[model samples]
Target: MRTTLNIEDDVLAETKVWARRQGLSAVQVVFRLLRFVLSGGMEQAETGSAVVAGFRRFQETSPKLVTNEQIDQLRDQVGL
Candidate 1:
């Protein structure tokens, strides 16, 4: 699936910045954008809290700053 693209320099720079902020590679960000557009753009399905593996997911309530380092540390502790 590798191919060359003629993306503008400014757009590619912006995408790289955004990808760094999200802890993802530039290619991953591009694919996510493509999927989002192809799947009806902002018209999403029903919204609700989702449960995975018997655990209900919820938004974080802490107002503390959570850095990528902290996330990686936790992931390592849990052997993720």
Candidate 2:
């Protein structure tokens, strides 16, 4: 499975750096990224979840427990 791609210079540079930091070769990194994208990983990222090391995906939640006024009041009471 040998092929050629025309990747942007900046994109390739960043991918190389990321691959080095993850202890993976550039080809491995590119392969995994392509697999992930083809397997709907981008949808998860768009929906506020991310895949982390060890193949774990976590959802981000924001519960509206307090309003801005409450936060401001608390900040003022804290003397700052």
Candidate 3:
């Protein structure tokens, strides 16, 4: 199947960069992105929960680098 679509300049540029980084052609990158989007893999509501849960798990397992009090102190020092 073939069709014509107008992609934004910035999007085209970024897609080219992504293609080069991934060792794929611009067409391949667009195809993959379109497939992902068409399949609803990029649905924010569905994905956001999983991403939030993963972050929560990571936060629980990871060591904290700074405390809220420390952040507040730094912010005060910076007159923020």
> Which candidate should be chosen as best, given lDDT against the real structure?
2
Candidate 3 lDDT tens digits, 1-80? 88998999999999999999999999999999989877556654343543443342232455668989999999999999
Give the Å error, residue 48, model 3. Answer: 3.3
Error of 1 at 71 (Å): 61
TM-scores for candidates 1 onward, in order? 0.50, 0.57, 0.54
Write candidate 2's Cα lDDT for 1-80 as tens digits. Answer: 77899999998999999999999998889999999888878867776565555254445476457889998999999987
Q: What range of 10 consecutive residues in model 1 has the weakest lDDT sum?
A: 42-51
Residues 14-79 of candidate 1: C-alpha lDDT, one tens digit per residue: 999999999999999999988975664523322244344545444456758989999999999999
Q: Pick the candidate with the highest TM-score.
A: 2
Local distance difference test, each candidate = 0.77, 0.82, 0.79
Q: After the best TM-score superposition of candidate 3, give how far the Cα of residue 37 lies from its true spot, in angstroms.
A: 1.0
For residue 40, model 2's alpha carbon misses the true position, in angstroms, by 0.4
